[model samples]
Target: MRRSLIALSLAIVASTSLTAAARADIKSPVVIATEGAYAPWNLTDSAGKIVGFEPELIDYICKRAKLECTIVAQDWDGMIPGLIAGKSDVIMDAISITPEREQIIAFSNPYARTKAGFLTARDGKFAKADGTGSTLVTTPTLNNAADTLKSLRAKLSGASIGIQTGTVYAEFIEKNFGDIATIREYRTNDERNLDLENGRLDLAFEDTVVLMPTVEKANGALEFTGPAFGGTLFDAGSGFGFRKGDDELKAAFNAGIAAALADGTIKALGEKWLKADVSP
Candidate 1:
């Protein structure tokens, strides 16, 4: 913990002074970044081995692409800047594609799509406004979001929801449920789970796959509710993220991603790790 904090502090302190120099020759053989704290996505297990979905998938893709690459464990916030500062070459984290991010960087074709969902402990009840719905209903495209939001509003009248800061999921909950419930932001899922376990927050909203390994590892302390959500609000999928202007690398990764999808490697890995084929 102390070492990571020191590294994070150093990255921030030296970022501005080193940004231009680091980003100069980013076409190196190795790219690096964090696993983004999603279990089975990217995490260090008990043996201190960096093992997870992205690490394994990227290893396969890099081999297919014939690119010499090295993967490392870094902080999520520093991942982008690490790329910008030439600290790493590729970030295999579960980075989502977004228009805003496009302004600053590029992304390879998506390898996976994990839908959004909310989780509230198996305890708690609240008076309803009308129909008395208690869970988030999957809406591909909510034409009447206001009406549907009332269900969440009714159930969470006085409850609190936890989310990771600076994410689309956080935005979703805030834009829709901010008026109804208190929103608490955590730096990582483990912290948020601690909050959930301790009753500090009533619920959490995030991707189902991102939460999968957590659920499996929990041995039944936490549980999910209702169907997975997607559409315009939740975004389409997760993909390989590249820095801006890195066209060659992005295209190479996209080709590898397409090939993996066709060969069933991605589906097989999804099933092996997550117990479900997340092919969408």
Candidate 2:
């Protein structure tokens, strides 16, 4: 009888431990991260509240997913690492999903599409050379993907280009036109755009969404020229980044985004923030 009791206690302990493990897995909630510095996407207001398009989108997605969610702000450089290290469940900070990042992380279906455009002064020499829209995606790099020197050397010639360091656009400019044009790196987009306005940099490359707002504020002073790039330098679209093996979470968000697109919620949000539709 004593031997039978010992076996029964062990079985009970094992059952309890298994139950606890299952509960842990089932109770884990999804947590999203974002960079508060990016405005209209994610930014901190005067009251220290993080608000923007991403916030609105995520809130709506959480409702759809039936997820108990929390949003945390992290610096852009650390957003991916945070996910890999399990510091956060996902990243919603307007980060463009690229092939390089997918090796270690996962992303939801792209919810926003944007084109790259070079912003220059309206009075600048390159003003009239700008293309219509989303030209860069289809425009193949004249040289290597890592180095487009041949393509940019002609347009830049002896000009100066300003880009925020650590940005893909900066990588494009330096790899391609470093030898031809003077390359200046800034700490932020606002700083680089300011320099373009101050005559410090001959050109600046930014997303059309951000560029239009700046150009509007500049009142015809800042102009975008050249073909806006997508695909390689840009991407298929922008989406929330998740940790590797989080395919379940990724799929959930993708479904929510799809629903948003189908019902026109995505377009409505884009129109609300960007005054345009970029959902795809």
List per-prediction Cα lDDT, in the order shown.
Answer: 0.65, 0.68
Give the per-residue lDDT digits (tens) of candidate 2, residues 94-164: 67667766776788889997666678888877575634333644433433332333444566688888876
lDDT of 1 by residue, 1-280 (tens): 0012224333321011111122223354555566445676777776555667777787777777666665567766666666666666666666777776666667777788776676655544532233322333444356645665666577677778888876778877888789878999887778887787676777777877777656666566666654346554555567776777778777777888888899998999888776677665
Q: How many clashing pairs in candidate 1?
A: 3
* Candidate 2: count of backbone clashes, pairs at least 3 residues apart or interchain: 5
| Candidate with the greatest lDDT versus the true structure | 2
Cα deviation at 19, candidate 2, in Å, is 27
Error of 2 at 103 (Å): 0.5
Badly placed stretches (over 4 Å) of model 2 are 1-29, 130-152, 231-233
